[model samples]
Every structure is written in C-alpha cells, then in structure tokens.
Target: MQRFRLADLAPAPWRNGGGVTREIARGALDGATDWDWRLSVARIAHDGPFSTFSGVDRVATLVDGAVRLESATQTQAWTTPGEAHGFAGETAFTARLDGGGARFFNVMVRRGRLVATVVAHRTSGVLAPAQDVQHGLLVLHGRFAVETPAGTERLEAEDGLLWAGARPALRATLDTPTGCLVEVRLSAPAQTDGAA
Candidate 1:
C-alpha cells in the first residue's frame, strides 16, 4: 500500500504540447520507451488532438471542468465529474472545452498484456480488494480516512492510494457528507514461460 499526493508531483510537458501531464505510477520506470501500464493525470488547457499510442488501451475520467471529445466516428460529452470515457489509444480525437480547461485521470495499458477498468463510487464503508487484481483509489472530492494493515491514512481531493500484489483488507470512512472515489482495477497478466 502506498499513498500519493498530487501536489508533490511535477507536471511534465505532453508530447503534443497542448497541456501537461503528471504521471502517478507506471509498471516500468527504467527509462523505457514502452511500458506495460501507466497511470497519470493530465490538464487540458486548450482544444487539440490527443497523442496517439498505437497499441495501448486508455480510460479517462473527468475530474474538473467540462469537455467534449470528438473522434472520427464518435463524439463524447463529459459534463459530469468522475464519469469515465474509454477509447482506443490509436484513435485520433480532438477536445473542445466547455468552459476553458479540464483535468482528467488516465490509465493506459499495453494491448493484449493487461485490462483495466475505471469507475466512480460514492459510498463510505469497507472496500475489500478483489482477487488477483490491482486496486487504486483516487479521492475526487471531500476527505477520507483509509485504514489498512499497513496503517491509516488521511486522504483529500487528488490524493490516491495504490494496492498491488497481494490484495489486502481496507476500510474507508468518509469524513464529509459526500465524496467521490475513482476506483481503478487492473487485471493481472498471465505468466509466460520461456518455451517454444
């Protein structure tokens, strides 16, 4: 279990230079051109086309502001916060800001190696980890007290908790009236033996 504060991370310039992105976590950090999986938050400041990642699967959730995504065959309106929109990384898309700018959380995984899901949950109670899966909880709004075998942590907006490897028991209590939680679940890839 690890806790990450959003403010502590420095933003990196995006490949397209339309905005900046803050990488929260990645499967490999050895300066590789390709990684198995990655989680990040990006700030969209202007309307532009997204950078294409040929063989990656992407899931994006709106955290602040409003925007509409236009692809070749589809257009998606993201007005509600915490709602996730998924698309193929290879798809070319343009974004139009409803107001001015927007902040979004993104999860990308290499095709055929892993699968992922991002969902919003509004509740207060125990959140047990799923079997053979990685869990990442992003606090979108309000405050929370998360308890686990490691320890208890106080999380605020933009704060996240990552639990990988062995699934552990976790309990979360809302500190405010209502809060939004972005639950990220990643399926573990199958092990391959050097054969054939």
Candidate 2:
C-alpha cells in the first residue's frame, strides 16, 4: 500500500483544455499510461465552460460551498454538502458559481468498460476487507489513517492512495475528521494513444 499527501500534489491544467485539475493518484503511478480509471481531486476556482470527453463516465461531488452545474439540456445547482451527480463524458457541461467559488472532488472512468465509485465518509470506523475489483482510495477533506502490512500512514485532505495489480488486505481508522473515499474497477488493459 502506498500513501500520497495532498500538500505534496502539484496542480496542473485539465486535459483537453478544460478547467484545471489536480491529479492526486492514478493507476500504475506513472503519468504516461492512459489509465482505465482516473481519480482527480480538483478545485473549481472559477465559473465558466468545461471540456468534453467522448468515452468516459464522470462523477462530481461538492465538498465545499454551493455551486451550479449546467449541461446542454439541463442546469442544476448543488448547494448542500455531499451533493453528487453523474454524467456522460461526451456531453458539454459548464459550471456557474453561485456566490463564491466552491471546491469539488471529481472521478472519471471509461464508460461501459470501466466502473468506479466515490463515497464521502464522515463517521469514525474501519473499512472491511474485500476483493475482486481493482481499488484506489483518495483522502479528501479530513484526517484519516490507513494501516497495512507495510506500516501506518495518515492522510490529510487531498491525499490519495493508488492500488492496482492485485488485492491486498488493509485496515483504516478515522480519528481526525471527515474524508472522501474512492475506488475503481477496471476490466481491460489501459489504452494507449498510439494504439488508438
């Protein structure tokens, strides 16, 4: 098991010229591969247009202030905390700020082929052992500690964990505050741009 710190992550521009996204963790831990699923932690600093992804499934959850989301057909405003929505990656979407800019956590996975889920965990507990799916966890917005055969590592807001290849038993304890949980399930090998 490997742990990533939020403060250590560097924010970069979003792919395909969309808004900026801070890539916290990704499968294989390398920036080259076109991963089957990607876990990105980002802050929507402004309200404007968004980019379009043709073959991806996306999930967005608000972790901070109120914000509004608009697509080609509908416009919805998310004000409450932990409010999340999913959309097709091919569609064009834009974000409109309500009053002030808000922070949000986003997860994008390849549609039909790859599967992913995002959960905001606020209670104090431990995660049970499970197998069968490739998993990755990102600590967003709280202090959470994970224990494994390697050792104990504490994750603060914006930190992430990337796990691939095989399943290994792990345990976690939340003694600090609220945090977000993310896991990904992939079916095929990662696609490369040259092959496509």
Candidate 3:
C-alpha cells in the first residue's frame, strides 16, 4: 500500500488553459505520447470546452460546487457534489458553472488498455480489495482511517491510498459521514511466449 498526500501534489495548468489540474498518478505504454491511464483532480474556474483526448475514456465527479455539461446530442447534464459522469474523451463538450467554480476528480484510461469505476458515499465499512486489479481510495471530505495487514493510516481530505498486485483486506472507518471513494481497475495485458 502507498499513501499520497494531497498537499504534495503540485497543480499545473491545463493544455487548453481552461483550468488547473493536479495529477495523482499516471502510467504509460512504452513512453508513448498517449498514456495508458491517469488520475487527476481539475479545478474549473470558468466556462470552456474540455480538452480532447482522442481515444481515451474519462470519468469525472464533482467534489465541490456544481456544473452543467453540454454536448451536441445531450443538451445539459448537471453534476453536483459526489455525482459522477462518464464519457468518451473525443466527445466535444463545454462546462458551465452553476455559481462560482467547481472541483472535479477525473480518471482517464486509454480506450483498450483499462477500465474503471468510481463511487462516492457517506458511510464507512469494510473496503474489499478488487481481484486481479489495482485499487485506490481518495478522501474527498472529512476524516477517514483505513486498517490493513500492513498497518493503519488516517487520511484527511484529499489524501489517497493506492494498492497494487495482490489486494489486501482492509477496514475503513469514517470520522465524519461525508467523503468520496474512487475505485480503479487495470486490465492485465495478454501473456506471450518469448519470441523474436
């Protein structure tokens, strides 16, 4: 298990200059321009078109405030706190804030390389690990604590924990009844025999 402090993540401007994003983790295939998967949080301060990612799949959830997404076919889809929306990265869309601004947690995966699910709740219980896949939990609000075979760690707002390989059993307890959890699953690459 690995812990990532939210304070340690540096915010960077988006390529389209529409918002600021803080990347949590990223994986690539042979150092290619298109990454295999990426997890990040974006702070949208104004209305604008979302950057296109070609063949990537994206899931985004609002953590604070609210926003309305507009597309050609879909007129308007509103996302409030803890509400998640999934879409193809190639889809052209624009976001308009309901009020001041909004913060969103996003998970992006290359079309054929990975699949993911994100859930947010206000309760506490056992966090069963996913079989044959990577798992991660991010605290969006309040205080949360997790107990694992390795040890126990407390997570404050925005902190995250990532576990890879064999998933370990863990228990989660929430100090307050408000928080968000993100679950990500990576697809295993096909095995191949040694060949020229």
Candidate 4:
C-alpha cells in the first residue's frame, strides 16, 4: 500500500507537447514500460490527436473542466465532471477544450491480457481488496481513514492509493457524510487457450 497526492504528481510533457501526463501507477510483466496495465492522469493542454496504443483498451473519466474528442468513427464530448468514456486505444481521436482546459483520470489495459473496471463509489465502510486483486482508489470527494498493516492514515480529496501483490488486510472508512471515489479494479481473466 502506497499513499499519493494526486495534485502533487510530477507531470511529464508529452512528446508532441500537446499535454502533460502524470502516471499514478503501472504493472508490467517484466517490470518495465511495456505495461500490462497502467493508471494515469493527463492534462489535455491543446487540440491534438489522441495517441494510439496498438493492443490496449482505455477508459477516460473527466475530472475537471470539459473537452470534446473526435475520431474518424466517433466523437465524444465530456461536458460534465465525472463523465467517463471508453474506447479502443487505436481510435486516433483528437481533443479540444470545451472550456478553459481539462484534466482526466485514465485506465489502459493490454488486450487479451487483463480485464479492468472503473466505477465511482460512494463509500463509507471497508474498501477491502482481495489478496490477488489489484485496486486503485482515488478520492474524488470528502475524506477517509485508510487502515493498513503499517498503520492508519487520513486522506482527503485528490488523494489516492495504488495497491497490488503481497497484500495485507486493509480497511478504508469514509470520514465525512458521503465520500466518492473512483475505483479501478484490475484482474486477470481465466485462460481460454485450453492448455491449462
């Protein structure tokens, strides 16, 4: 269990200079950039084509401001905070701000290798992750108390935790009336090759 402040992540300029991205966490078979799955936040600073990821699928959730994204086959406008959109990483879409600028939380999973789900949860009790499961929880609103093997700690909005292997019994409790969080749950799918 690792703690992070979303607003404090260091941003790296995009190769095309159209945006900046802050990687929250990633998992790779070889522990390198060739990620099996990745979680990140990106600032769409200008109008440019969304980069393509050959064997990946993506989910982008609007965090702040608004933007309109278009591709040859589809156009998506993110006008509301928390609105989420899913697409093939090879869609070749372009994005332009609908307002001032925009920020989004993104999840990308390598095709046929893993499965992922992103959802918003109004939390109040234990946020327990199975020992073999991977989870990312970003506090969208309110405060929380995270209990882990290390100790209990407090977290507020824009704070999060990325968790994976060698897990411990953990608990996360909402500190306010109602707290909302974006939950990214990743898991491996059962093999279908019939070689098991």
- Would you list the C-alpha lDDT of every candidate in the order shown? 0.84, 0.65, 0.78, 0.80
Highest lDDT: which candidate? 1
| Worst 10-residue lDDT window, candidate 3 | 181-190
List candidate 4 stretches off by more than 4 Å: 30-33, 131-133, 148-150, 166-172, 176-179, 193-196
TM-score for all models, in order of appearance: 0.89, 0.76, 0.87, 0.83
Any runs in candidate 3 off by more than 4 Å, and if so which?
29-33, 75-78, 188-196
**In candidate 4, which residue pairs clash?**
none
Query: What lDDT tens digits, residue by residue, belong to model 4 across residues 89-146?
Result: 8888889787577888999999887778787766666655564457787876788787
Stretches off by above 4 angstroms in model 2 are 14-18, 27-33, 177-196
Indicate the TM-score of model 3.
0.87
Q: Alpha carbon lDDT of residue 107, candidate 1?
A: 91
In angstroms, the error of model 1 at 109 is: 0.7
After the best TM-score superposition of candidate 2, give how far the Cα of residue 47 lies from its true spot, in angstroms: 1.6
Give lDDT tens digits, candidate 2, residues 66-176. Answer: 777788798777786566777787777788887776766677776665666555556555555545345666664667777766787677766667666565665666766
Q: How do the residues 1-196 of candidate 3 rate in per-residue lDDT, one tens digit apiece?
A: 7899767999999877788999988877657786788888889889999777898889887778888878888744546566788889988889888888888888888887777777775678876666745667788788888888878888888888877666766788888756665555565555668998
Q: List the residue pairs that clash in candidate 2.
A: none
Give the better candidate number (3 or 4) by lDDT. Answer: 4
**What lDDT does model 1 reach?**
0.84
Q: Which is better, 1 or 3, measured by lDDT?
A: 1
Q: Which candidate, 1 or 4, would have the higher TM-score against the true structure? A: 1
